[model samples]
Every structure is written in C-alpha cells, then in structure tokens.
Target: MNNYNLNHLKELESEAIYVLREVASQFQNPAILFSGGKDSIILTHLALKAFYPAKIPFPLVHIDTGHNFPETIKFRDDIVDRLGARLIVGSVQNTINDGKVREESGRDASRNALQTVTLLDAIEENKIDCAIGGARRDEEKSRAKERFFSHRDEFGQWNPKHQRAELWNLFNGRMNSGEHFRAFPISNWTEMDVWQYILSEGIDVPSLYIAHNREVVWRNNTWLPYSDLIKLRPEEEIVEKLVRFRTLGDITITGAIESGADSLTKVVVEVASSRQTERGNRSDDKRSETSMEDRKRLGYF
Candidate 1:
C-alpha cells in the first residue's frame, strides 16, 4: 500500500506557486498575461491555487490581436468572469489608431508581430511594473535563454547578453524607474509536463485544444483555420478535418494539428509520445530561424 508517485508534478506546482507569490509581494502593479492558450491557462490555474480562499491580487491582461479565434475570446471572457478577475485588453487595433503601431499588409502578414508594441504600450499605460507569463525554456531555443525574472530596459527591449546572472534560485526583480520585469512561473516545465499536470489536476482548457471538426486548409506544413482574417490564396482549398490547435494567437497565423486526442487522458498520451514540438505548428515561429528570438528581444508575452 505504498504506490503514490505524483511528487514530480507536485514539486512543479509548488515552485510555480512560490513564483506567483513572489511576483505579488515584490511588484507594485503586476498582471498575469492571459492568452487563453494552454500555457497561460495553466498559469491562471496556478495563480488561483496559490491564493486560494483569497482572490488573485493581480489582474489578467490580454493583448487582443483582433485576429483571435471566436472560441478563444469567449473562453477568456468566461474564465475572467468566473474568477472575478479584472480583465485588461491591450488592443493592437487601438494601438494602430493611436499611431503607436502600424498594421502589416500582406496575405501572410499577422498581428503577431504588432502585439509587442501593444503589450509594451499597455505596460507603460497601466504602470505594470512586472508582467507574469507562462513561458517555458523547453518550448523553444530562444526561450531557453530566458530567466525566471527577466529584465527589460526603459524601451521594453531586452539584450540577451545583458541579462542579469540568475544563479542559485536567487531572483533579482529590482529595476529602475520606467523599467520592468517579466516573470515566468513555470519556466522550467516542458510540454509533456504541462499536459501531465493538467491531466492530474483536471484543468479545463479551450475546446480547440481537444479534437474537433473544423474547416482548415493545408499550407506552410500545417493546417490553417478558416477565418475572416485569412484571405485564402488560389492554391489552397478548405476541407473539414478532425484537428486541434497546439498553440493559439492571431488566428491568421496559428496552425492546427491533426489529432483525435479529444479527452485529457488521450491528449496526455498524445503529448507523451509525440515527435513534434508543441510550438512546431506555430507559423509565427516558422517565419524565420530567429523569429522567436527577435520578437522576445523586442517585447512579448
């Protein structure tokens, strides 16, 4: 009668909870960046767990790309309302209107790049000293170099080489005026780790994560959802497929994976034995070899 071995997941949970609490205690105005994606959902769940019996002290910030999936937006609103957490939307469209950013023009252009400006503008406008996110080092090579408490300059830009030495779990969140930090709670967790944790905790995510029938087109080595944001080229044709999204954002660029992992158990199994990286289906990252690094350097969620 001695076969309980969920300690690994428990440890990860504890570490994330500790980071969330640290963010709350150290930053004056901190907000969790909620993207309605798998990672961000886990962050929200951890925040709730960290401050149970008391409401989450920080608000949830969503940088709206205007090209989001309808389901993702609905799920975001529902989660915020259910949690009674304040929601702030940094609209890329509004940033465009303010002349703070410009909309890219092309069949392949997406608001993914424009989101950086909107996110940084939001930080400046809201005076958010620290922004918490759910990025993991194992997700991509660029993020692998990120620190638990990453610093940003006054312009919201990050010099990868200038990153402070983070050794022995000693995080230095202190920053000068007009500068801020981006804290990642589950920065050490991997894709399989996330799925396993979600499975163990029964955390609910958007339906798109589960297999479903949707109109999609094959392009750029992945299935692209049919949406108003996309103007299908002549070479592409829509067909119904039982597919699910591995990542989400700027519907125009997000890609879907062909799968039948509808249940959490099935999804965990799929993730456990999958060959592709979770971010493999993301067209945004596939834009160039240094796409993610370039974006993270500029400012991102």
Candidate 2:
C-alpha cells in the first residue's frame, strides 16, 4: 500500500485545480480574467496544468483601464499568443468617450473605478456566463468572505451576505438567466503562499516585480510611477529611485516600494518579512475602509 500526505500548500493547489476543472465542466461561456499580474498569471498556469494535453478551454479577458504598465500589456499579449487563447479587452477610455463613465478630475484621479463599468459592459457584450478571476481572500477584508463560486445577479452585483454555503467541496452553480458567476480558483491563497508557490514552481513574472531604477514621484506615501497620466502638484517632484511594484494597477495610483528583491527567492523572503498587505500599494482601496466591498456591490470585479 502507498501512503501520501499532502502539505497545506499542495492541498490548496489541488483545491484550486479542482475548481478550475469544475468551471470548465460547468459553465457554457466561461472566460478567465487575465491581467498579467502575478495572481492571474499563476491562475493561467494552473489552468494550463489542470487541462494538460489540451489548451485552456476558455478565452482570456482583460479590462483595460488604459493606465497599465507596458510590460504588463506585453506579457498579456505574449501569454495569450503562446497559449493560443482568445483575448478580449474592455477599454475604459472607450467607456469615457461614450459617456458611459466619467473620468475623474484631480491630481490623483485614476480610471481604476471606471474599470467596473467597462468590465461589466464587456461581460454583457461578450455574453460571458462565468468570469474566472485570481482574487484571493487574503487580499482584502471583504474578499476574505468570498466563496469559491461567487454568484452575481443579473446586474453583476455581489451580495456578500446572501452567498450560498459551500460544503464538502460541492458548489451550487445554479443561476438565473442574465445572472453570472465570478469564480475564484485561488481564493484561499495568501500573498506569502503566492510568492512561495511562484518560487517553487519557477513561474515567469513581469520584470516590474524585480527591483529596477525608474523615475517616480512621492505621492500618497508611496512612489508613484512618473507618467503623462500622473498629475504632478506643485509640491510633488519626480526623482530617479530604485523601486519595484508590489501590485500593478493604474499608473496614477499604483505605488512602488523601495526593494532589492530581484529574484523569486528574494521576493519570497521579502514577502515573508513584510507587514503591510499586498493591497496596501493599491491607492483605489485607500479611498475608504469598505471601498472594495462597496465596489463589489456596485458590480466591480
């Protein structure tokens, strides 16, 4: 007889893989939300592994806020091409031009909030029944209460309190017409677990994660990337600094921290010793304590 004991991380990976298979086996028009971020990249890799001997069964969707790093866009295109997966992009700029959303006017204004409208529009236009995301519970307080198969109403709104109870790995994917599901395959993984898994699996990530010298401005207590979209107040000044992005988002709001962690091993060590949450670098969440929760209620992913 053979005996096997799975570690916690392996158990999580197995569970995520099972969820990926379930999405493929259940949904009719499923799509994976791929932003080329570490979380999404890991999810894509896991999906590939889950369906070994066959290409991913779903298309890749990117809700483009029009403020992403060039490296992230390049990585997104490259991965989609390599995997032969279809890519769908919903542009926020288009939404603003069409008057579907309004662009904010301020020194720190960002299109991050407007991305929700574009994302929902994309889902409706593409008729995507299920959107698989890489959102993890540890990322935010509200996200911690998310289910593996999170249901969304016809308007794509999330009711956190009314979520179905998941028991014994059974998921109730039943939904009414026009309603959809937001599936999170890696909902239980934490930042440290993600870094450790990336290191262990030798996953390829964007160069922005590694320490590099770039022109940045001090804003909101973190170094903001110097970009045309980034407004500079009279007090703010740009300077060259050694920085790396902990989480990639709109250039106007995403913060980079001073780091020398250039490799996956170094990154894992840094994450293990870090005190701040990964979303700490994201300025959108800084708007309010329940910002993410409110956004989720309003149909934001």
- Top candidate on TM-score is 2
lDDT tens digits, residues 215-249, model 2? 99988888889988776789989999988888887
Give the C-alpha miss distance for residue 113 in model 2, angstroms: 1.0
TM-score of each: 0.96, 0.98
Can you tell me which runs of candidate 2 are displaced by over 4 Å? none
The models' CA-based lDDT, in order, is 0.90, 0.90
Model 2 has how many clashing residue pairs?
A: 0
Which 10 consecutive residues of model 1 have the lowest summed lDDT? 3-12
For 65-112, candidate 1 gives per-residue lDDT tens digits of 888899999999999999999999999999999997888887678788
How well does candidate 2 match the true structure in TM-score terms? 0.98
